[model samples]
Target chain A: MKDHAGARLIKDMIFKCAVCLFAFISLLPLYLILYYITKNGIMVINWDFLFSLPRPIGESGGGVFNAIIGTVMLIILSCIMSIPCGIAAGIYLSENKKGKLSNTIRLCVIVLQGTPSIVIGIIAYLWVVAPLKTFSALSGGIALSIMMLPVIIKTTEETLKLIPYHLKEASLALGVPYHRTILKVILPSGISGILTGILLSVARITGETAPLLFTAFGNQFMNMNILKPIDSLPYRIFYYAMSPYPEWHSFAWGASFILVVLTLALNLFARGISVKWKIQF
Target chain B: MTDRTMLKERFVKWVLITFALSSLLFLFLIFVFILAEGLPLFLKVGLKKIIFGFKWAPTKGYFGIFPMIVSSFLVTFGALVIGAPLGLSCAIYLSEYSGKKTKMFLKPALELLAGIPSVVYGFLGVIYIVPLVRNYLGGSGFSLISTSLILGVMILPTIISISFDAITTVPKTYREASAAMGATKWQTIYKVILPSAKSGILASFILGMGRAIGETMAVIMIAGNALKIPTSILDPLRTLTGNIALELAYATGDHRLGLFSTGIVLMVIIMALNYLANFGIKRKPAK
Candidate 1:
């Protein structure tokens, strides 16, 4: 019995050690990525990189002003197309849980969520770019909006579903109109979750390059037109990193650092807001 | 209630319904547009040749995607091999072994990992993993091995988070009973908790595989995008998603159609995997 106990204890110790080792090994990639990006990217992030346009070949001082603006523009454009309808569709899902329409809508969201970003980009290209005869930020926005819709719709539905049914009933009992009750009472109660979803969707798309590869097509000069092709941070990283020039590679690294910072900040902020501001009722 | 209030409520319901219908309309339109663009390829080239043909020289009038199909499966399988063990270990640690502080730290860390963009992961593969593979292991650093490693790391959060939740949900009574029977913690975990949570863990594995199959930019950066079927782990290869992203920029005529057809194939594969995962989820332990 004593020998058996010793063998069992030794086996348990070995298993625990192996699990701990493997668990830390899984985190190795995250550390390597953060270390490499910060090391290579921090040197090039002065004001000029943030505010000025890329320079012509052989000129050493140009910035990625165009890409930064374009990224923000794309985010805004996608949000405009996605948010209101995402909330309404979510409301429909929550209110009509057992209907065939809701089931179909739920299936659509799942399918869309699983669809590859590049696939979405291609369809967006065929739909908007081919029809318009040009690659444009609008097309990029459309592609991104499609990606955003699933996250927003699911988040909104789950959040609103958790709100006490009595709250909705109480609002109706007080003579609030049906629309007002939904729009004012239930929506407000779930604002933290809704906002967190929107922020997370934004963060997800902010570093997206594949979807924007064809639709945005990318640009070199500073331009604001929705119909024109625009440079985004991810697109710029892809283009520059693929280029042979050492200077271009440095620009890619700097852009990557900014992109990483942008995404991480958005993610952390979304979580913070969701946890801190969620109404307890 | 006033008539105006009643009328306004009805109008608002219509508006919400319209919005809801529009959401479904978007999904419908995506299928329609993809099919409209891609279906002609099959009619023009026949399904067998496009799907089974080994060569994909579009300019020379050939568009076989058999190699890409093979590459997609090979890399995804390799990723699961590398990732699943590490991911499961992490999930076990988080759900069973960790102190409160470690769990808190690790949970947010995984989210940060997921938040890192695919492009950056690709960039990292280019600069970091590729060099290591080339210098130490052999071949051009850009090969099946490098792509699989990058993908393995990329899918860890998905596997860890899902399985962690699954393992955590196993009834506390199961653990107590196993301990009462004189089982060690490891034995109890393997016999009771893991079996109870197997469906969820399987669901996570399936979802991670879906992610690996669909990943494009990272594979493109590391996989060398060769058009041939790789006979070894160090060989470079193209995948369905990579093929579309690589050629769509300049492809026109039948080549463009070919890429769209590739998209259709990709969507079907992903949706099928998702269906499988959902089946697993539906069968999850109620307790």
Candidate 2:
């Protein structure tokens, strides 16, 4: 061990450098992805492209107002359907931690969470589109809400679990009703964490193209009706990027840029809230 | 007021329980409805043929999906080959070599990489990876190798962050003991730290495999989506997920059922992967 000390030291140094070198190389994709998206998409974005409706294939110069509205509506609708149920479900799991029922529910959530997005799209089509006889925003919202449930439920449950039992016990001792204590006291304390989870889940679905492909279908013009088919950033990107026309390809690039921005902002915003607004308790 | 409180508590508890149970319901419904829609194809074509049949032509009444099955698992294996080592090296770099400031900067940079939508990765693959592979390697840009390379990048964040978590859990005393025994730092890491964190790292790779298999739009674009089974990494091929997404829009009759069956197979494989990962994570290193 002592005779070849210098050689051993040199070998370690070389190995360390190799590790660092390869690690740095692994991150090149992130830089390449961000730079390429910006390079290809930046020139395509302008007020006209952002605000106005897209022109038909032959005509030039339009916007993705429909996709923006569609993305917003899908987010809102999914949030409405998922947040309350997910939080409530989360509360149930945390509150009833030891039971066959809770155990089974947790397993199912894991399975659902792991299920592929394309498979979820098929389920949405069969459950909502097939039965309703049309592709609409309602089905898309349902699909996204299904995707959101496991995330929200797991995050909320984990967050709630970390709260000291004394807090709940103190509320019960004060003669506060169980429902009131949970709804008002326990939930408020974990609000930031729950909100963070919600934001991250929204960000996850924002770029989802498969589920909405058959569920929301796509629309060319502005739409607000929840029952009607709608457009979203990802769907728009897919439609235009696949088109043979160069102009449409540019639209796809612009939409891709918009999507990357939206998801990245949401993720950073979630991280910020979790870091800055977390309750010390 | 006391009676009303009791009633309200009971009501709320029941409501929450119902919501909690809904996840199971969703899973059950997906399985049942998908099976219901898909069983017809199996019955019409026979289970053996549906699963093992080589041909996937629909208009001619053939519904074999053997090729897609190979492509799905093969692509995931290829991604694992590309991603697992790179991700592990990066995880070791961040966890062991870097200081707190570097860790803080690099960790979330990885998360941001994960947060980028899959389709954007597909777009990147189509424009960037495809051309490079075509120009350099002498095949169509859209090939199994290109898909694997891009999917490898997509799965990197998953593998790296989880493996980082795993590596950090190795006891500090183990490293100290190794160093005291005249071991080099590299020797200590390879001999002690990695062996201890094996389960966790294995779990991370399993989850990464699931993500790679489940990916659709990204695979659809850069995979070339050919129906044939790939003879080499340079050949274009379609995954099971790709097949469903590509044909479901216009498929009717037994064709639609076959697509649903394809979904069923995809879900089952993913579930099996999740099951293995769950076991891997749950069995922690002995204290």
The most accurate candidate by lDDT is 1
Quality of model 2 by C-alpha lDDT: 0.90
lDDT tens readout by residue for model 1, B110-164: 9899999999999888887898999999999889999999999999999999999
- Provide all candidates' interface root-mean-square deviations: 1.0, 1.0
- Give the range where candidate 1 chain B is weakest over 10 consecutive residues by summed lDDT: B15-24
Point out where model 2 deviates above 4 Å: A1-3
| After superposition, candidate 1 runs with Cα above 4 Å error | none
Tens-digit lDDT string for candidate 2 (B70-163):
9998899999999998899999999889999998999999999999998888887877789899999978978999999988989999999888
Model 2 chain A weakest 10-residue run by lDDT: A1-10
Interface RMSD of 2: 1.0
Q: Give the TM-score of candidate 2.
A: 0.98
